[model samples]
Target: MRRGTGRRAMAYAAVVVGLALSGCSSGGGESADESAAPTVTQTVTETASPTETSTSPTTQTPSGSITPTAGAPAVDGPVVAQDQLSSPSGNIWCSLEYGIECEVKESSYQPLPKPADCRLDWADNQFRVDRSTGARGICRGDVTFTEQPPELTYGTTSVVGDRACQSTETAMTCWDTGSGHGFRVSRDDYQLF
Candidate 1:
């Protein structure tokens, strides 16, 4: 009987010591429950009133940036077409321009080595082949081409008139009816038709 009682006492003492050690083992003296407490986060946003007219310059955001220029005139005419041009050295040039803006790109490319010109006559709503040489092509009006970013997955096909565009997570392709004059926008490089 004495030996059994001594063993029982020793077991009880061992349990008590184990409990005490566990209580102190928590780091920074924080309880286990306190350490596992959930954290809360708050986000705040500000909006301007309709009556407010901000004179401050435009600011850029993390996703994208657009700065308003003082002397830049507002773009006129609807966007009719888009084109992506690629070079033999694997350089990509993409442009999404309105009918009037296409003329600007065409005249601007006159001095450049690459054929970056996309001339459009907004008055006639026609795509011009070569403004300097007076070549004419198709006519498109108010047809918008939304560019698909490389990160987006390409699913299904979006066709417009004689054009078809397909997008993948890493690549996008827009082509004419015959796949003759088109381009592919990819994460690695742009392929022109």
Candidate 2:
């Protein structure tokens, strides 16, 4: 019976590791690496089960301590919504509404801490919240800005190490294929294409 329990625990661990990997980035070929970067549609599913107390006499010794087998929560972490991402730049922006907070350099924007009103809209062009290169970070998904220009569409994914440009249309969204670093859609014209 103990052996069976251990096998079940191992199976659960494997599933979790698999899920985490599927969301990670790849280097040369297709592989998973979580530290890489996260995309928009990345969904995390958690199932909550009611705590069950075993009535087995032998399992419950006189020590009065209930021993958990495995596959349990080791630490407590806050449950962040999919729209809200905690980037290395120290700013949290709503991927749905307000534009991403990033650094603007040489027509490129990298994630960085900034005020809520990062995008200064104009009739023709949209200025982004300026960030210092010293505080560089990754951009995740490539989303479209239906408002164009002054609206500065967000959601473009550059390669893990390479700096790519965000397109004004669908060119800005990143695929879940696992490109480790997240990126920002910059208004700059410098293209690496």
Candidate maximizing lDDT: 1
Looking at model 1, residue 74 earns an lDDT score of: 21
lDDT of 2 by residue, 70-168 (tens): 211111222111322222222212132243333222334432344355353211112222221211333333333322222222332221111222223
Query: Model 1's lDDT to the true fold?
Result: 0.32
Runs in model 1 deviating more than 4 A are 1-153
| Model 1 pairs whose backbones collide | 152-169, 153-169, 154-167, 154-168, 154-169
lDDT of 2: 0.29
- The model with the greatest TM-score is 1
What is the TM-score of each predicted model, taking all chains together? 0.25, 0.15
Per-candidate total of colliding backbone pairs: 5, 20
